[model samples]
Target: MDWIDWGDAPTWLGAVFAAAAAGAAVWTLKSQRDQIDEQRRFIAEQSMNLGLERQALLAAAQERHEAQARKIRLYPQAPTYVQVVNDSDDPIYDVHCEARGMPALHAVELAPSEGVGAGILADLVQGASRPYVHRLGVGREAWFHVVTNERGAVHIRFTDAAGNKWVCDDAGGLHEAGA
Candidate 1:
């Protein structure tokens, strides 16, 4: 049996082995690069999806906040006075009020009267009887005096500048009025 000697291999064989190793190295490098690119693309897509999801969540939260902020409440502070409060950032217009068995009340504005006084209260109550167009700004209120024999419950309606109607029923439920 003859034993093969690697040290006495042909020069061509050595060159061939060297070329094969080089080719293998290049192929491995290209495979690694392609895998890295694919991973990068996946990560980029995931990031974009996360961003869109975050925006959608933020928009939903904003809508909830706005709905909560734009509510109006009617409280009978006294037998003669009904306080109307605007709790939103937007202005409320065309204020109208009706109780169980009382005359329908309309006002120029149902806004905060800065100081509590007889004269101011009387003016506010008197103003509601006349046809007037006004706005109640944010965090403001006005008081209406009731001279009715029946003031058990009251329903108030108003609109924003954007024409969105809001109604506050005696049950304390605030909701959007119909179109």
Candidate 2:
């Protein structure tokens, strides 16, 4: 009997090639997944850093605003006497005080009825004196006077004819005129 000639290749060659292809496909998929995960992690890190930077900037700005607000709130508003020492020997002295949180003194009218401008400091320095007689005239006891003592330093205090006293300095705001 005549038998047909068979190819010299192994019967399992096709199956082996198919298995290798499947394995390579799985490995390629895993590698792609790993790359995608790394990209996602980098994006997340950048976002977190950006958020932190924004928070820090906002906090710094808020701190500065609060400090300025505190300064404005604490600054004196009532009649305040500020003595400035000039370094230059310029004969023309400049007395400059910004109203800041206080009402502008330029438009203020110190009348007897106001009960605020009768003080000697307002009348003498500001030239805003009224005709009404002071219950306690301007003197050592007046509640508004700046006196230059024997020393080069200047002294200022508020004294009422009724013997009320008030003084201002680094210690703190003036003690009540009568206190």
Candidate 3:
């Protein structure tokens, strides 16, 4: 192999290589720093946008529910319009005219002597203990489980039974008692 001549190398060539290496190092470092700053800025912007978008979505959903007339009407106007919802999906029994208006108060009563109306009454009376009164929506709206199996209250309301009123929940549970 031929021996390399370090002395013969041009003096300016070494300076040129050193200058280029330094320039390249500076460029690489600056580029990396700039990229890190840009990424941080991008992440911060996304977080702010997400928070705003979440609030907007919640507001929109609330607006949609509030705009519905039927849902609005479902909210009780008086304390008596509410009934305590038992945590069951059974049929309603012993529907009386007095129970029709809002629950006004929760009270326990003897089972109706007449027994529940034929069809749904049979189902509602199942496992039904002494009659109980629970003021629904007394202080606030309540989420009651509606039982639609028995239609006695529905029929009475449709036929216009005098002194007979009914409270129907959104889910179709109807309560009635002689007023």
Q: How accurate is candidate 1 locally (lDDT)?
A: 0.66
Q: Write the per-residue lDDT of candidate 2 for residues 1-179, one digit (tens) a residue.
A: 13533452454676788889999999999999999999999989999999999999999976653331122111232334332121221111112122232322321222233344445454545645432112321110122222211222322233322233433332234344244
Ranking by lDDT: 1, 3, 2
Q: What is the lDDT of candidate 3?
A: 0.38
Best by lDDT: 1
Q: Write the per-residue lDDT of candidate 3 for residues 25-87, one digit (tens) a residue.
A: 999999999999999999999999999999999998755433321121132212222222322
C-alpha displacement of 144 in model 1, angstroms? 2.1
- Candidate 3's error at 137, in angstroms? 21
The candidate that wins on TM-score is 1
Q: Which wins on TM-score, candidate 1 or candidate 3?
A: 1
lDDT by residue (50-104, candidate 1, tens digit) is: 9999999999986764473356667765555566777866777877666664634
Sort by TM-score, best first: 1, 2, 3
